[model samples]
Target: MKISIPFLGVLFLVTACSQPQKSSEAGDAESAQSKFAHSPLVEHIYTADPSAHVFEGKIYIYPSHDIETEVEEDDMGSHFDMKDYHVFSMEQPGGEVTDHGVALKLEDVPWASRQLWAPDAAEKDGKYYLYFPAKDKEDIFKIGVAISDRPEGPFTAEPEPIAGTFSMDPAVYQEGEDYFLLFGGIWGGQLQWYEDQKLVEGRKGPTDGIPADEEKALMPYIAKLDGSMTELAEQPKEILILDDEGNPITAGDNAKRFFEAAWMHKYGDKYYLSYSTGDTHFIAYAIGDSPYGPFTYQGNVLEPVEGWTNHHSIAEFEGKWYLFYHDTELSGVTPLRNIKMAELTHLPDGKIQTIQPVN
Candidate 1:
């Protein structure tokens, strides 16, 4: 749901360059908190990119299920709207969410159609993997893994797609028994920032940047699933977006690559990597010690939502730390995003703190 990097500088653009003034009603952003609090958090429908999960103790939320299309004039084709995903849950920390209907859809995904975008939910061995992204039936754009032993789903897809995955947000991080997943960038060009040129898969135009020996083919891949978690048990590599003297961020310089949704967590021992800093509006991060990194960007934690792309996810549940994300300021357009959340701190010696986007 991102990709505007007007030339990489404003931190990396995504609301397709802005001019969007929308959001003005705060009087009743759902009565100002306490229905459960923290974020536009979900009022009736519209959601996007979130993907959190604490599971059995509650904090679920699979997001990316915003719909509102009377055929608006976004002309950029489908407006990235979406067909289904709703799976809120909550129960504690800021409490009250629960909406679990239609866990995964796009007509039940046979080879996919439309463009279902962003998703992630893992549990492994016991079963519950959702990793999504659609546009197949030859329209191309891979990424799919649906199985479910119940994480609120009628989910069952896996008839294909994921074999070598093409692109589009599809997070999934397990670590311990090893899971990984995380996907590619967009921006009309599946973006590769600087020397790695992209956008030519589901089609988008005019690129012309690949060099540094093709900069590891542009970066951002991961892969390592298997256990029948819907395929790709290995062979995906790429993550090396380095530079603090480690080198590897190509396209010539100005660094901070990886212009996609690409999340990934794990606080204490390090390894953050957040994303979505394409054309501007913020939402970045970097720091590394594993999980295929070469990272080191470390900056911009978020601050850019009033419509124009801002996909996110950074859970912690029961002990605090939230930050779902999305903002059209309530149907302010920008694909009518919605779904928000705030309250994410950390600035002691650990980093992260720039949130700003509440009611």
Candidate 2:
């Protein structure tokens, strides 16, 4: 039997943004070498925000288990809990997977105290590290790290925040020489940018060049981590605020320009940073030659499909890179999402081919 949990609203946004239009240069998508071989039919797995690490030749997918229960209507006024962590193990060849049961429960942690959200897990040395965002003392959200000897964790947390309240949805990367963590930007009202008091004609608005008037909008941010991968510190360089063509998308009305669900991986000489755009359930991408990027936005990679929001994870396994994401097809057009996968292809010119579900 399959167990279903809800609470994934933005997890499938990449699919929402990745709709395929027949390219003038291509044969049908099926004829393309890069399309996914198959797509799954499942629902409410909330297997959103999926992160996989191959352990001893097995791939495990860990996602927040925000299970809902039948309770009195008066008690229904409650926030979801990240109390359960679900694990899925994939079989070979067909990539068929079996649900591995709840691997960890938040109520099992004394300090966790409240809501749990996105989690990214990786294996280092002989241990598995899981980094996630959860509520701290004042009920404010912060990122924290946990360590376990196995991929399916009974993880233990450190005494402090690995990344501060300003950070969430972290993707950790270790290049040849250093370690880094990428996260969504905080809406630091004071950090916003603006044009001079003398508004320029034809410009019609602030032309300060910083997108979103970084002074007033939420932009994605990154921090460098030490070799130990614990502390989150400001990098030596200036903070990166997501901007489109030197103009900031700073209006409160335009906050969706910021990237969410960001992860960076370097292939050959290029680094691909994938993210979900806005809450419209769309996914977009950018590319950079370096980890610390002057990345050029490549536009939305996935658009909403069926009823699913667009969001995804890119992973390389057994020499193949795949996009792992979720969709809302079976549960109609709501937040209930399911797990899906597709093959990812990179071209010689440093451009990545957009991924789509197998028909």
- Candidate 1 has its poorest 10 consecutive residues by lDDT at 1-10
Candidate 2: worst-modelled 10 consecutive residues by lDDT: 188-197
Candidate 2 local lDDT, 238-355, one digit each (tens): 2233455644344342324553577777778777777765445566666766777756666555654444234466777898877777654333322334566666787777777765
Query: Evaluated with TM-score, which candidate comes out highest?
Result: 2
Indicate the TM-score of model 1: 0.31
**Each candidate: RMSD to true structure?**
20.9, 10.2
TM-score for every candidate vs. truth? 0.31, 0.71
Every candidate's lDDT:
0.68, 0.55
lDDT of 1 at 142: 74
Candidate 1's residue-wise lDDT over 41-124, tens digit each? 664556777878887888787878766566555323356758878777766765566676887778888888777878888987
Model 1 gets an lDDT of 0.68
Q: Highest lDDT among the candidates is held by which one?
A: 1
